[model samples]
Target: MPALPRPATGPGSRYTARAATTRTRPTPARAKPDIVALARRLTARDLWLTALIHEHRVLTAQQITRLAFTSTRSAQRRLRTLHHYGVLDSFRPLTVSGSAPEHYTLGPAGAQLLAAQAARDMTDTLWRPTSTGRIAYSPWLGHDTGVNELLTHLAAHTRHHPHTRLPLWLSENSCARRWGDIIRPDAYAHWTETTPHGERLLPFFLEYDTGSQTLARVEAKLPGYAAFTTATGTAPALLIHTRTASRELALRRRLTDPARDLGLRLATASLDQTTDTPHARWWMPLEPTAGRLTLTGLAVRWHPLTPATGLEATDADTPLTLPVPPLPPAPHTAP
Candidate 1:
């Protein structure tokens, strides 16, 4: 839930925008935004972007492009305009030398605009945002943005494959509400891939990691997944996305470890690094071969979790079937 506005000294208010940060030499004139021009240029998509950033908290420029636009150039252009108009605020994380991509969150105007767009009442008085210093100095900012990138890629992927339905996408915060202390994933989603035989609903928990997480640390999360499934008898797959192929390889060992038993079926993949698009070729399984498989094809690799019933019927005369839990509610998008 979005919090009410806080005092200026509030350290980490999600609803508040930070003091403006200058990328280069200070451009004092840019402080005052051209609100009128910005309002004139706003699109429904722009308002959607505002709502998205509001929901997810922060997004890098690349994630925004994948989520809302066809290309990075166009997305960046709009982001710059939004920032200039004080509708979106951003800061770059500390890099070794070269510049880092700007991370964005909803600005005061953007949040208010989104609330109004959603037909929600806005009665708060102190509408200021988090301080720029707080965002820049946040320790988990990079990790949070990495999770956003993974979810954004999944969100974008479904857009291209009309047959693939992303029914329920719960953010980390949303997951916290749904699962409480039972099992909190970086993101939780139910994907239904339509096929001639029928469709299969894949409920999975996302554990997106940058290169920073050690394999041991990765293994530590296994018990939680196992416990969740044991308690609910609803064993969802665990999809891990890492920064590097090496990291993916190392994590795979832990995921498929023979020594320690883990309940959740697991698959691993590297972050989508090639094109703006995501494809089956980008997803790798535990101890996978050279050829990659589509999301549902992953079922072949986790037989215990997804027991095969037989060859899926290709013709209308034959109906495809699988042994699994009762069909889930028709896929619906989570707010």
Candidate 2:
């Protein structure tokens, strides 16, 4: 029989062999929890707690109690609820010798849940009209001082228009769907108009662009509208751009060809950046008949696109009144 080879006999040889074996061994990956499922199981209060955990990473019950303004017992209950629902995985014990204070961490599931909630919140806030049925407006969308000024002006214009009822159809981070297969405008004004026959539906579509000088996203949406017009035989009546003269001029140049091809009408409004009020206050054009108007302004205004329930207007002292035409009538159906 062939002689069996002897194992290497050298100082540190065993250690080297053991080290190689250890290096080749695979480390098990940590298991992540099901965030979506955990979110579904949470109540409103539980969701709030989960959000804090997801944002801050790990929080202790005592800390959460103070931050959430809850009693120690209530905070403890909330923490236990999350852990039981699998929103949180392992917890760190406070100490080895005393009563263990648990520190919570968002499991994989919790992280996923928070992300999905944030996305939903963004979508809802962006597209929905305000509770007051007022026009939706946003300043952050404005790319620069010029664009901001324009938006401010447009907002003012809408507010001052008595003939035009500019109800918010969308705001930043709001969700909106279209009519049938057609692309609808970002914001809408539904007002009754006294036509020769009687009251008729007069819906105005408003589009606000900040003139960030990037039209990639806006241009992509145009094709959908173009297709819709071809199929439905209707196009948005108004396209508004809030931008500097140069930027607006440039947009006009680029959009002129498409506008002509799509049979879309464009409206341009200029905004002044020096003012520190809502853009609506500055840009909205007042009706000729609006002789003596009372304007009430709020320091911080809420989005009009959100559904209102018993929420008073932020500032009633300085209400804005203009001599615009009276609203025709409320739509029988919700927009």
Best by TM-score: 1
Q: For every model shown, what is its TM-score relative to the native structure? A: 0.68, 0.33
Tens-place lDDT digits, model 2, residues 106-177 = 543455565565544323222221211111011221122222232233333444444333332222211132
How well does model 1 score by local distance difference test? 0.58
Task: Please give, for residues 42-105, the per-residue lDDT of candidate 1 as tens digits.
Answer: 7666656665665566777877776667677777887887776667778765453445667787
User: Residue 38: error of model 1 in Å?
Assistant: 8.8
Range of the 10 consecutive residues with the lowest summed lDDT in candidate 2: 11-20
Q: By lDDT, who's the top model here?
A: 1
**Runs off by more than 4 Å, candidate 2:** 1-164, 167-175, 179-185, 191-202, 272-335
Superposed on all Cα atoms, the candidates' RMSDs to the truth, in angstroms, are 11.8, 22.1
Q: Relative to the true structure, how large is the alpha-carbon lDDT of every model? A: 0.58, 0.36
